[model samples]
Target: MVKAAFKVRHITQRYLRPPGALKEKDFIGRCIRCNQCAEICPNNCIKFFGSENGADSMGTPYITPREKACILCMKCGDVCPTGAIKPIKRELEPIVQYVEMGKARVDEQLCLSYQGKSCGVCYRACPLADTAIKVGYMEQPTVLDACVGCGLCERSCIQIPQAIKVIPNHLLASQLKATHLKERRSGDNDVQIIKFK
Candidate 1:
């Protein structure tokens, strides 16, 4: 079991996961999931959880904006002595250099555009120097195929609420799913739906 755990950690690290592939940034991203960011959050936006996902990031933590968007509040950043989550002026900087997040996806079924109305707020809001998100004539207006799931659409949606969001990579999310199945068979007990607590 120890060897198996080591292998999982080694593989996850091998992937050079998180904080992007930029080596310079990874230096600041060696987070041990200490929950400092979550704890310091006044808005209770940052959240973490035990690894029901896999041995790799088992007990690993992630931040879900839905708990509360960063607001660029800087509480997490100020408390992050290790610089795990950087702080920046919400208006002046990109906040999260979005491209580093991952490729974006537009679920047509859930998207307002696909909801039979021509709402193109996302395209207009997306910062378009090398626009990762854009609009195209898809017989129905659809987000450009080049979208990098950066949550911009979700953040900028004006449909009385958000209509888009950044999402974890489909392949990675599936692998975690498989890990869950494996864990269930091992009978370590209790499966609970994790919430953003």
Candidate 2:
């Protein structure tokens, strides 16, 4: 019975760790699992909870875009005084995009665009101008097609912490297609729509 219990414990540890956490452990040996990352996140992207997975994953920081997304604000990683959520230096890679947490999505219901509000915070803050995020709509601002995943909108969002977030590109494609389909259903007339603001 003692031997069997020990074997079960060993197997449990082997399988319970998260794949996302492997890189973190490879570099740091083990995380302190401090809540600092969650506290400092500008977009409140960090989630720490316990589950059937294991104790290690429990209360450990991970980002979920459906809940919140990393803004490339780097606050969580940077504040990791322990270097767990490490940042790869742009100087070292040279050509990499720095941080690609994911693509940005506007929840029209949660967005000011649907409300006809006059907030250009996201459009104006975007570094790539129209190439990154553009403001559409006749009077209200909506995002036009060209988004480079730069994350300035995620940063500038005034929602406590922030409403906009960076998500992985894999998830965005299907969501983007669906959003476009909804626009088509509404007869938005993309051909004649000209957005300057």
Score each candidate by Cα lDDT.
Answer: 0.46, 0.49
Best TM-score among the predictions, by candidate number = 1
Candidate 2 per-residue lDDT, tens place, 54-162, comes to 4444556655443443444545555665666564432313212444334455655556655677676766766545654656663233443444344557667765555
Candidate 1, residue 153: the lDDT equals 50
Backbone clashes, each candidate: 6, 2
lDDT at 44 for candidate 1?
A: 60
- TM-score of model number 1: 0.48
Query: Considering only N, C-alpha and C atoms within 3 Å, which residue pairs clash in candidate 2?
Result: 102-167, 102-168
- Candidate 1 lDDT by residue in tens digits, 1-197: 76664343322321211222122225224556667766776656555544433444543444453333333344555565565545434332353453243344455666676777777876765654134554556322344434434344556666543555554443335545766886788765455422111
**Candidate 1: which stretches are off by over 4 Å?**
3-29, 55-60, 65-69, 72-74, 87-91, 94-99, 119-165, 169-197
